[model samples]
Structures are given as C-alpha cells and as structure tokens.
Target: MENKIAFIRQHGIRVRIHALLVDRYLQTYYDKLGWFSDPYEVFRDIVNDPDKHYIFKSILAKTNVSKFDLPNKEAYQDFFGVNPVSSFKQLSSHCSWTGGCLLEKLERAISYDLPGLLSSVSKAAATPAPAKAAPSPPPPLPGTCEGPGCEEKPKNRWRKQ
Candidate 1:
C-alpha cells in the first residue's frame, strides 16, 4: 500500500510534499500530547486536514491534479493508451495550480506547532462517551407467595381443596 501511495505521490498533480509534511508534523504532535505512541499513526487522523481538502477541491474542479491523481492511473493509461507526461507537464507549469499553493502552505506550516492541534483532536476522539446505566430488574408479581412457609402451587389450580 505504501508503494502504491508512493507511486501516486510521484505522478499525481497534487504534490505530496505538503501532505507528507503535515502527516509527519501531526504524528509528532499527537505523540507529544499523549494521544498516540508514535508519529506514524497521525496519517489516519490528519487526513481530514487542509491537504486533503485541497485534493478534494482539485477533484471537484476536474483539474489536472485530479486527472493525474486517479488511483491506478498507470494501469488506466496502459489499458487506454493515453500518455500522462504531457498533462503532468502542463499541471507542473500552471501558474495558479492548487498543488503549488498546497506545497507552499505545507512549507510555511512546517514551523508552526501543527501537532498541538492534532493532539487536541486525537484527545477528543479518544474520549469515550459515558456509559448508560443498566436497566433495573422488574418487580415481583403480587401475591406470588415467595416466603419459606408457602407451599408450591400448580399452574392455574389448587390441589384437592
């Protein structure tokens, strides 16, 4: 899976530098906050961050980044005979590409304490909801005669009375 993700990182229009940086930062942050044992686990938690939001925006816009980031794009090209290099080059050269912006923010955000945010989020998520009290047992039926001196009675009848 890492290999596949790495391949996507290489060819996808959305540069992964920012996502990777954020992921690394969030992990350390989560760990320091006592939310996670290591920095690696922040991938699942920080996936909803701005990096992913940028990817979603690209996908919604049907931009070059979205086209390039399709899962198994290489296989798709092999089956369809479409070249990816031309599109990749165009996207790389685009003046206002979101990928470029994402990369820039990732660089800027690197110095900031992103882990603190992630740690707070992780702590909130880790907190379990309060358990509901168990239901009370039902009361005994009236006139059941459960005392020690009472004789056992047959269902719906009294014996030889």
Candidate 2:
C-alpha cells in the first residue's frame, strides 16, 4: 500500500513536469510559425500525420526525453501493448482537441493526494447536518396571547368602566 502511494506521488510529479515540457515545446514551435489560435490542435495535427511525426519525434528527441520516461508509460504499454501510442494518437483524431483529456488521463494515473480528497469528502459526508435547529417555532401573530395553548384575541379599545 505504501509502495503504491509513493509511486502515485512520483507519477503525479513526472506527469506534471512532462505536461509543462510539452506545452513549452509546442508553444515555441507555434511562436515560430506565427500561429497562435490553438496550439494543442496544432500539436495534435503534427502528431497524427506520419510525415509530421518525424518533426514531432525530432522535437522530442532534441529535448532528450522519451515516451518511456513518461509516468504510466508502462501501464499504457501493459494495457494497450499493441498500440501504446494510440492513447496519444486519439488526442488528434477528435474534432476538438484541447490536450485536457491527455492531462486528465495523466492526472488519474497518479493519485494526486486522492487519499486526502477522499478523507475530506468522507468527513463531510459523515458529519451530521447540525440537526437543522429543529426549525424554531414560528413567531407569534400580532394581538395573540403569549402563553401555552394561547390564541389570538382582539385588542380592547373601549375605556375601562
């Protein structure tokens, strides 16, 4: 259990770092092209084409990084051994690509203090709802008597004899 927790933390850190690196790389390329509309889509287009894959691979290689270095790469391989890159490839296949889905997958791969979130959620769920204060008795109506079993009476207006 402890080992799993440690791996999760490490995975989160690596994924975050990788995200920053990918964003920086994409931004730089986008800047060079004078294109600024949507960088992730550009990145997706680059990744999806075999011709462009070389450029993408060059960019990655220049950074001295590998897909294998990414967190959960093994899990990706284990789960989708036939096409480990398919997970990333799908990012481009979609009509609208934001890179958010990729980030989410990475986030989920790592626990990201999930235990803390769960504990806080559990504490909130376990807490009693302050008993609702019993809805307090309604305020007495005007001209009403102020004793138990009392009812409203008309105000006396005549002068006392």
RMSD per candidate (Å) reads 20.8, 18.5
Best by lDDT: 2
lDDT of 2: 0.50
Candidate 2 lDDT, tens digit per residue, 1-161?
45565666666666665554445434444543444556445544543442333443543565544566543433422433353232342222423355556555555555445656555667777888876556878997787679778755667779553
Q: Which tens-of-lDDT digit does each residue in 1-161 have in candidate 1?
A: 44443444354333443243333333334444454454334333333342443534444363223433444423422422343221222222333654555444543343333444455657777898898998997886897776689868566565555
Write down the worst ten-residue block by lDDT for model 2. Answer: 83-92
TM-score quality measure for candidate 1: 0.24
Hey, what RMSD does candidate 2 come out at? 18.5
Query: After superposition, which runs of candidate 1 have C-alpha atoms over 4 Å from their true positions?
Result: 1-80, 90-92, 95-100, 105-121, 130-132, 137-161
Query: What's the TM-score of each model vs. the native?
Result: 0.24, 0.29
- Give the runs in model 2 whose Cα sits over 4 Å from its true position: 34-100, 108-161
